[model samples]
Target: MSDLIPGLPEEVARECLVRVGFDQLPVVRRISRQWKWEVESPYYSRLRKAEGLARPMVALVQAQPTADDAGPAVHKGSSAAAATGGPANFYRMVLLDPAEGRWTALPTLPGPMESIPLFCHVAAADGGGRKRLVVVGGWNPETWAPMNSVYVYDFLTGAWRLGEPMPGPRRSFFACAAVGGTVYVAGGHDEEKNALRSALAYDPEADAWTALPDMAEERDEPRGLCVGDRFLVVGGYPTQAQGRFVGSAEAFDPAASAWGPEREEGLVPDGASPRTCCVVPGTERAYMLHDGHLVARDGAEASAWRTVAQVPEDARAATTVSALPDGRVVVIGSACHGGEQTVYVLREEAGKGGAVWARAPAPPEFSGHVAASLFLEI
Candidate 1:
């Protein structure tokens, strides 16, 4: 029998191929048909994870300036709009390695239209031994209308494939979270701008969405977090209270197929909504960016929210707050909207007071407003 890969035993070659980083997967795939088949197979991703070779990556949906908007100062080969004549306000997915501080642009999402929607919800899912980035409903860039399109990008294949479109009416600004092997989406507004209570869960293996019970109340642009097995949908408002949101939050138990009663008191409190909250994995506490401070609450306790650490004065209203797998918290924001962006990492010391925020280096291209950010272990 011939070796599966060149000049090596089949078993040894497979081990080496699984260790290849996701960034180099595309190039590795082009090496040969056997190499491509091995990389794209479910067994490969499973082996990568089992061997502890998968790396953590941060993906951001960011706005990119067009050639005209960029003032005709084009770099040698770094302009997407200059080559394609796409829309002036374009958005693309950019990946960053927080440890290495390196940035690489992925292939633009393949869609009938050239532009990405506004306020799209994005989540990363590792299911069926495959790692994928899932982008849920958002508004049409050209018409400013709601869309139900669901797109999944496979890191192994370096390609984007459309998943089953979200069932029913178009939704925008929905809350989405990946728990275990499933991606759950809830809330958001419809075409008429009415807040929706509908929710659904998608299984990557099946490539289908299963509708879950509607939320107790209409919530548009709510924040979602998967703590343990429950998916919590936090503070968002109805059409009447569009600007002012309620302080309540609700939790959905997929196993029970029902949503718990909404807590009317201090789930989100004042000045903090779902968009400003994040949960650190393996911790029982949920953190929120509230009034220039980082606050925490025991998920088990109903109303015991307390301050954890003070956020940097400049990063008051952060656009994204993500919890790294290593228990570090990263906050990204700009002094002014779409102006110079700054990233802060908060690390907790042993027996020390609390986490102290330190500035971190971010790519110059990430200075634009971050529409969405997700942390994925690939």
Candidate 2:
């Protein structure tokens, strides 16, 4: 045990090791075999959380701070790029540690792809004790055509690698979510611009995708969520009825390997987009930005939604409402269309006066447009 860290008591060494930030872990693991095993042990991360040392990090697909790697301002391009019309701005992935006000830029997307697709969706899930994030399907930046690409990022290795792309028939604006280490995607438009009802699940561990049964109806640009163990595909317009949302939601039961018959209605207002929505971690209940408020959907089967808190006014426009693993909701966006992007975190368990939104200071480099954002605790 003394070998764990030259001459130090094992328990004291462990306490020092557990306090190391996630970004510094890859280096720490290389110090020695004993140190590697000690940090990678299942209990290492658990101890960090129990001791309040685990930091909640947010990964964002945002506009580049400089003129480098910009893309055209098109239908599916980043809001930041379109807002600042002088030049096409390329989107890159960045990680932010709000507690420390630190930002880390991830390696650029692989191959000829210069930036993340304009509308590609991102989902985070646990993979063998390491935090994993996946980015899937959006219009290719180079060609402006739908792409079937899949890219996975591992926090432990601090690298990006390509995964198996979605099976044929590339789609766009699909709803996606991760539940129990599996990523699910459904209800988006096909290569022919036709809406689709098909669904599929991807196992990051196996680097494979398996098709699920079709939904009761075809939907385009729907919002996907996980409530408890169910995958909820909600509020998208059918193929021929573009821009006219159906205002209902359906659930996929993974255990039964089938979608249930019932669908809850009033999930969204007619003709409105449901892009700003996310599920609360652990509880698996839905939360979203609705009518200037942050609200949580009642449960897996009900249409009821209760107001959680008012979204900060600056972030009310063009918002990506995601709930952190710590049960805080971080709203990322600007005051109005084309405004500087900022972050506001809502503490769900605040002492009184209802939960309040505390604005996290964002540096200019991290303030470009946000295409999508997801939370991870490591």
Candidate 3:
């Protein structure tokens, strides 16, 4: 029944409270019972956004810093690395503030386990005011065997919970995307190393899985994106084709729970991995980074990727791209193969010209190989 703060107008008090940075929100809740309710209220988030205070947080499952770390590394040493199937699973989640160039790590995942599974699928979803990070499927750290595990992290609680394990045979390298609090997974190889076309949708809230129609192709290592209202599986090699990737892509309409006819409209170029393919949030625009160039998948016009910018010289070799909510992109990678990793922020020049890349200062610990990444505009 009290105003947000004693002596001030409720509106003025809210404006001050909302201006508090996203990182400080957790602490703000402990200030007072009324303050906690105000910030935790769903409308508080909308009001903060209206006041231009919401921040898009970038999260990465990056390779952990090792004991013998030189300055910045993208992989681990022989003994330390080999424990997690080379440099893949030996990673921990890190958070980066793209605008401020700040780096921090997420809370440790549950269990005695120190690292995430190798090649795990990571996705972020903000539904009903709950910002959650979902990590699913990958090879076991010690045994290197395929796992159907699922883990969910709630930003509000700053803790992780092991969700229901993925149903069916364990798989690895699958395509995954999050939409409406549900995570959709398709393709990847099974425990016996067999490619799969099957797909499933997971509701972390219910801890349940719903089987969807199998994809038209037996994609081995496809990539996924949630573009608009659809989930797209792009560019994966069939079991018979092996390493020869196809340019075709498949789209799944969650509303109808059915896949559209497979299309070959250049989802990814032939023989290239869609590993670098991504969709920028807010803009909801898709993009692909291949060779040394960044291409935007033009949705409103041609439904194709147009060259937007060239990858920064330092990040050309092993690039991983995650876009801020405003569409400003942050690329992290090494100059050459197995080289020191670094950060670069990219912006578009005016007049539909091109892009500019600025080197961002990244702490040595956060400057490493990015196994998986996503952005949550919370």
Candidate 4:
């Protein structure tokens, strides 16, 4: 490769080949030989796609720094610190680097329960180089209650397996994305009561559970997305009517199993009370943070809903919004008032009335637990 691109320094080999991922950077260019032709050059692959650097800003598996190297430290604790008790308050397996805002915390989940609230949906594996990370399902304290048990978590083995489960008993659901390997659980509110249109899928390589074709509009905290392969469900409030947030919208097409017409299309932008969303994988745009604003949709063809940014009025009934692969958009640990909780991060600078809202850096521990955020690549 022309003597490894004439001796290195192409923006530090394109940020170490986009943090070591271009099918594993030729084993770090075999120890030397001018970093294996400046990371198998092509001008470091067009300066790694004009600096969009494809993927991997985080992929976590740390915990080897000893001799006071400051290893295990991500204690921004407080999801009410496990109610200030004597044991149960755990955390480890972290990777929050919104372009270096920092928090690494990995190593520990060999299972005895030292951490498990990174709440489901953290998949990535299709030549994108392996990733799973699924935990935080319900009950199961030794089968004392509700739990369709699922605990995959294996970013190439800091391990923990046992996938496939979820034909029933899920815990407050509404996740949307993860096509081929399955996982598209939407609309849930069961303890044996209301809300649940039953649209399941969890096929981690056929460990199995498949029962799609449901949603005719029976949302609980509705708001799902998968754009390209189709499965866009919006708005919630199954029933508990006071005016239950239901502007409606549906579209599920797993290659024509059918499900497409439920359009009420109501309040989606600052109309107040629909809150709860997640989806930014490969993008067509979709963000709906409820009430204080952050409603956007670009699915197109008469699909209008905008307010782009204005969060932090304590996030009005906050239901947790997270979509960070660096394009930034986050809201964590909801539910405020006395048992306080808040975490926001959305900044689009290039100033003069663009996109702004920043408060992130205040989770010394959360209260009223429930915080979800995923984008692991490294």
- Per-residue lDDT tens digits for candidate 4, residues 1-378, read 443235766665556555565445546667677676664554554555567665443332222222122323433233343344222334344555655466545445444444443333344422223345555354432223545666665443345676756766564655455554455677756776478777776666555767887777677656665566776767666756523666666767778867786445553532344445655667756676655677766554446776777676675546556665446776654445433556667855544557877765633422223344545443
lDDT tens readout by residue for model 2, 53-102:
87888889887754342233222234444566532547788888866668
Ranking by TM-score: 3, 1, 2, 4
Off by over 4 Å in 3: 1-3, 30-36, 70-89, 300-304
lDDT of 3 by residue, 1-378 (tens): 988888999888988998987767778888889988887777887887787777777888887765455243344533445565345346788888887778877766676555688789998865666677899988777678777888898765567899999998888889999876778999998877788999999887777899999988898889888877788888888778878898888889998989975455656778989987887765557676876898876563465667888887777875577766566877778888878887777887758687888888877666567877777776
Cα TM-score of candidate 4: 0.28
Error of 1 at 48 (Å): 2.9
- Give Cα distance to truth, residue 229, candidate 1, Å: 2.5
lDDT of 1 by residue, 1-378 (tens): 457776888888888788777878989988888887888787888788788787777788877644444444422122344455634456777786777777777777775454556778887887766778888878776566778888888876788888888998888777788887889998888888899999999987689999899888898878888777778888888877885777777888878989995465747875456686887776657777787777777675646778878888677758888777676777888666656667787876647767787887764544556677777888
Off by over 4 Å in 2: 9-12, 67-87, 261-263, 301-303, 308-312, 325-327, 348-355
CA lDDT of each prediction against the hidden true structure: 0.76, 0.78, 0.78, 0.54
Model 2 has an lDDT value of 0.78
Query: Number of clashing residue pairs in every model?
Result: 0, 2, 0, 15
lDDT of candidate 2 at residue 177, scale 0 to 100 = 87
Superposed by TM-score, candidate 2 places the C-alpha of residue 289 at a distance from the truth, in angstroms, of: 2.1
**Candidate 2 residue-pair clash tally:** 2
